[model samples]
Target: MDARRQGIVEVAARLLRERGAAAVTIRAVAQEAGMQAPTIYRFFEDKDALLDAVAEHVFATYVAGKAQSAGDLDPVADLRAGWHTHVGFGLANGALFALLSDPARTRPSPAAEAGAAVLRARVHRVAAAGRLRVPEALAVELIRAAGTGVVLTLLDTPPEDRDPALAEEMLEAVLRTILHDAAPVPRDDATALAVAFRAVVPTLPTLTPGERSLLTEWLSR
Candidate 1:
């Protein structure tokens, strides 16, 4: 990115932090960045474009910090740490979280995709460690869904009335659904057994491709 463009994004992001999304107008960003409002058009086509850039700039810094924090921790430990950090970040930045989660947006921002990539990498590590019960993709979606839901629900509640255990409990629930050491399935948990069996169907040498597919389809139902 050009230095001027990066500077604009940083300035916009700061405004978004100190104020809200409405504060990141092109004119405001240009003023903060020490440029004319018209000059912002050289980098961003419009206000929406500038906001998208601001979102990317802020989230990319967050993702970088998350990636850096991974050290000697095991895959599961690292995953938990990442989850806590994600929840905290979302709670701390309500405006950015709402902007990134906007369904009206035509598509995900580049930095949003980068954040997902970081989660995917962590889930992949768990899969590689043989500690993941569900497929990596499914596990990622479950965590993503749960984390987003948890944050939004908390944000909606009055802080005085919010349940302190909600986020932690949600994470544990998702972990149990996806991890190898999940709470044991009840003897009558046919659905749980089916899902577990479905995961190993491809490794069953005795089953032909067609048979595996059929079994997988049935289990998915």
Candidate 2:
């Protein structure tokens, strides 16, 4: 993007941060960017385009920072770190989160998909370590559903009345449902073994593609 287009997006994101999405009109963005309304039109076909760009611009920065901070901690510990980061980002960016989360939306944004990819990576590690109790996709959904609800509920509450421990409490509850207390090895639990086996099926040595697919099909069931 040119300096002018980037400037317009930055100004619109600033408006969202300061005054929420309703303040991000083309005329308002133009006034803030020191350009005319037609200039914003040249960069964005309509209000929805401009607001979507603003949402991407603001969220991609937070997602980039989270991606960069991934480190050498234990996978489970790292997963907890990710949960805290996600909750913090949601609380700190209520308007952008609201816009990105659009309750009526049929699909997720590219930016949201990027964030979900990060969570899936984390769950994959836990499964690879033989600690995941559910299928990887199911674990991802559990965390995501709980995390979004926790953040949105907290955001809807007055800060003075909000429960400081709600986010962590909910994370623990979801983790308990989806993870084993330790990596169970050849234990009596068929489900955990199947989940862990499914995690490694993609890399199983010397199996034909069909064989791998067939094995995974049974394990996933």
Candidate 1 C-alpha error for residue 101, in Å: 1.0
lDDT of candidate 1 over 38-152, digit per residue (tens): 9999888998888888887778778998888665588889999999999998988888998888888886888778889888878866665556666667999999999999998
* Pairs with backbone N, CA or C atoms under 3 Å apart (clashes), candidate 2: none
Cα lDDT tens digits for candidate 2, 1-221: 89999999999999999999889999999998888999888988988888778777877877787677565678799899999999999999998888888776555677888888888888888898899988999999999999889999999999899999999899999999998887664499899999999999999899999999999999999
- Model 1 weakest lDDT span, ten residues long: 182-191
Task: Give the Cα error of residue 63 in candidate 2, in Å.
Answer: 1.6
lDDT of candidate 1 vs native?
0.82
**How displaced is residue 33 in candidate 1, in Å?**
4.0
Inter-residue clash pairs, candidate 1: none
**C-alpha displacement of 205 in model 2, angstroms?**
3.5
Give the CA lDDT, 0 to 100, for residue 81 in model 2.
91
